[model samples]
Target: MIVALTITKFRSFTIPFAFIGMAVLRLPLWLNKRCRFWKLMGSGKDAQVDLPADYRHWAILTTWDNRETYDDFNFRSFVMKWFNFFGSESFTILLNPLSSHGLWSGKQPFKTQISDINHTEKIAVITRAAIRFNKLKEFRSNVKRAAEAMRNATGFILSAGIGENPFFDQATFSIWENMESMKAYAYQSFDHSDVIKLTRARKWYKEELFARFAIIDSWGSLNGVEINTNN
Candidate 1:
């Protein structure tokens, strides 16, 4: 299976149109039988979950049967057309799951089982959670510091914050130079590690998903800069 993630930035004045697309685009996506699962999400102000969403930015995450299926959707889907006309900039990455654990809305979205891939390969990580209503305050208090620590870590590339709802559902999509580099930050960074421990101790999430992917392809630009997924 292939996963396609697209992050688009709409013009300030066209924000309303982008909002409309979120509701309207669901129809065609649901009608496409080739698509296994999908999520239409809004973005955070920076690379981590934060108060006040980035009104001009949004994202779509979809799982497809294969590369051909994604190609067909990319070339002809109304979803693409909507972004092409309304978005000022966009970036998309095509991935194959390396390993996945936990649940996303009660289902496993990524199906790849290859966890023994080379450590030198570029890696993509997706960490998402449905925060418990009562734990929102604690979750928010710690996320920003962890996010800031990550940005200064070695081999870090880029990331975007995405979720179904700005408040309850939160997720982070990040890319790193390799597994070692990614693990270093995930395991060694004090702030991030502390937050991880707190989450388990406090039981902050109602549901969560943590998955890794091998970056197969990428295109377009984000904020006017293209990402080199292969390197």
Candidate 2:
């Protein structure tokens, strides 16, 4: 099923550029080399826009075949190299089609489907971590497990890197089918609960942010889209 991935960062000029130079440039190359990588997911027709000055970083939106493909890419490429490079954070939100949609300067109204589910539910998972320099490795490990659990859970659609600068603490975004599925894995699942417990017990993060949104309207590329003003 096609899924949407969104990567955003807090405000910083140098940090985002560094990510562009390093992670962004290498990502397409890495995807090309990977066995399960699909086509680049984005809008080629429109000119890319700059992130607002008020915002720290821009959001990268893309689509994938399924959660498995996305997970493989993350484990093999992103977690190993990309995550370590920039102090970035991300949140992923799963989107279901609300109505017939189309792009490319008004073609016929494309018949829309959820791609995963029927309802138009969009859940966003946002996580940020602050770890002691000495415990960075440990923090990374824990976060990795949490991410993996999230991937394994049912109703997962897409997950992405959060911020542009991740040297100190990092964030991640994941999309889920519904709040119930998200809560089941995040709050009830065994391994995931352990990760959460460790995060709190060890004081791994200085601060974290999380919120959920229902997709009201979406336009643009899969890697990035313009959410509706109503949302």
Candidate 3:
């Protein structure tokens, strides 16, 4: 299976149209047999876990049958046409799952058999959770510190704060130069480590998913600039 995450941006004047696409684009995606799992999401400012939302940016995370199936939909479907007409810039990254654990909506969307991963290659990580309603305040209060830690870490490329619902359902998609760099931030950063501990001890989430992928292909742009994935 292939996972594709596409982030699209709209101009101020076109924001309303782009927001409407979140609802209208669902029909075609649901009808398409090639798509297995998908989520329509809104983005946060500066890719941080912020309380206020980024009105102009949105994202689509989808699991497909294969690269060909994704290409077919990307080129021939109403989704692309809608994006082209309303969006000012967009970025997409195709991923191959290296390792995945945990559940998303009670199901595992990314199926991976590969156990060994090359640590030197560019990598992508998706961390998402459905926060328990009771723990909302705790979850929100602690995430900013971790976000701040990650923003300045070495080997960090870019990240996007995305989710279906604001506050309660949240997720982050980030890229790193290599596994080592990503691991350092995940395990070594004091602020992030503290949050990790709190998450387990506090049981902040009702459901959660953490997955890592090897970026196989990427194209387009976000925020008016193309991401440099080169080593």
Candidate 4:
């Protein structure tokens, strides 16, 4: 069970560089040298599509064995420094492997390595919802309906908590097998339609959406706790 950990941050040179050093370089090195990390790099730097300009300032995908290992690494590593430096906001997903998927285009950070891990074409659709402060309950209820419908469709992956964001409005994250599956659920489903209608009707959002497509390469616990990994 590889979990998806997606971190998005506003553009800042110092923070983004630190994230690469700490999470991609330092953390992996520490894990391989000090703990247990089954190192698997993707195909090449062109494995996936780059995030949209608006959202490309920072992002990363890493997998983990379980929550326990993730927790251990978080408390014991320099990873927190990256988060602190970037003022990061994150969303995580726990996925059950899907047999069919889509491939991300070139331009992604770790594109090459990603293509090697899971050659089968797999696409992931990530939808982020941010709601007003007092509308948490209503927003969640609506999102729950959409999630339920999406999960019922073929190629559905497990979805997790709509975690709170310290620096932004309420947030929710979900995973899907492919773009088609996501489209069917997002566009054709009745629940999703209602959510959209309500959102537009109420004008519940204070900001526009931010999203991206990424290929997960390899992930697992650095220490022993399960941490969400991207690929």
Candidate 5:
């Protein structure tokens, strides 16, 4: 499957349209024939679990049927027109889903795939969740610790926090040197493990989606740093 992440930082004068465009982009995202699942999100100020956010920046994550289909929309679509009209800086990332579990909006966007990650592959993992209203405080409280743990985890490369709405629709996208290293962080880290356990016991998420992918390619900047394709 095709998973794409587009991040755009609107010019100060164009911020209003960026706000409006995010709401307007939803229709075409769902209506598009090739798109399977999509989310329009805001970004945290740092590349980890963060509280303060930058209203000037936004993100869009969508799953498409194939690479060519995504390319067509990326290069030629109403959404692209909006980006051109209202965007200043934008980055688009294309990925291949190696495996996925759980759900987003009650549906599993990516079907289960075998654990075929190779030793040389740079693994990309994404976790998206819509937090339950009552659990917001707890979720936020644990974020700093979890972010710290992740940042310090072995083989960790990079990561960022994103969401559709503040404190509610939250997600994290992190890169690892390989699948094994990612698993070690997910399963062995006490801080992360505690957060995961609390998520289940507390029922923090109203809906959630977890996915793993093999990095294909990326362009432009995320949080002002260019994506490193070789890593």
Candidate 6:
């Protein structure tokens, strides 16, 4: 199974240094032998809770052939070099796809056995899409309410609004207490259902991807609180 290694950082007062250093570190990441696909992302304020844009926070989303491949880069690549120099706190999550559909930049970036939808386990969900130019207003109008629904939803852990570009391009990464809990919120909630239905019905996105993963392992903090990702 391939895995998604996503990490978000929260920097200290020296914002300029961390920002520039992170951007410069991408060259090394793109060249990493073990990494199959990757993205440099901007993140929201907190992970467990859905929040607005937080400039001090940024993230790295990448896929690897296997755990060892990811581990090698974690310790040996320039990605680590930036981590050492930044002095900010971060959290890294490893995920195994349970289910996935659609594409990311015209390609699927993950592969794993189909998940047991009824299984009770910690889970992660990622929703990424490039909003269509003509449908931008429609998409933008729906974001706030959907975010509120996520934050207050039952069993919700954390959710982050991230993107390659702010506003125009967007994605969400959220963790849940269990599959049942996540499904309930995603499928049963009115606001969320409306978002999903219209996204398909109106073709709100030019490109999009939706995936569910089992939390294989993780460490560190998302917003000063360490999460337990061993499942």
Per residue, candidate 6 scores C-alpha lDDT tens digits across 1-231 of 656545556465656765776578778876676688888777666532245567777777888877888877777777765755564777788888888888988889878576656658888999899988899888878877888898889988877777877666788989898888888888999998998998889998888889998887888886678877655
* Candidate of highest TM-score: 1
lDDT of each: 0.90, 0.46, 0.86, 0.42, 0.81, 0.77
Report the C-alpha lDDT of model 2 over 56-172, residue by residue, as the tens digit. 344443334555655565556553244334524443344333333222112221223434233345555544444567766677666656666777888776555434334453445
Clashes (backbone N, CA, C under 3 Å), per candidate, total 0, 24, 0, 38, 0, 2
As a whole number from 0 to 100, the lDDT of residue 158 in candidate 4 is 40
- Displacement of residue 218 (Cα, Å) in model 4 is 3.6
Residue 215 displacement (Å), model 4: 1.4
lDDT of 6: 0.77
Clashing pairs in 3: none
Model 2: CA > 4 A from native: 1-120, 220-231
In candidate 4, how many Å is residue 201 off? 1.2
Q: Candidate order by lDDT, highest to lowest?
A: 1, 3, 5, 6, 2, 4
TM-score of every model?
Answer: 0.96, 0.46, 0.95, 0.44, 0.91, 0.89
Worst lDDT 10-window in candidate 2: 43-52
Model 3 stretches with alpha carbons more than 4 Å out:
none
State the lDDT of candidate 1 residue by residue for 1-231, as single tens digits: 899999999998999998999999999999988999999999987324554698888999999988998999998989989987899888999998999989999999999856736657889999999999999998888898988888888999987889999989999999999999899999999999999999999999999999999898999887777789877
- Global fold similarity of model 4 (TM-score): 0.44
Q: Give residue 68's error in model 5 in angstroms.
A: 1.0
Q: Give model 3's TM-score versus the native structure.
A: 0.95
By TM-score: ranked, best first:
1, 3, 5, 6, 2, 4
* Candidate 6, position 16, lDDT: 75
Off by over 4 Å in 5: 46-48, 112-114, 117-119
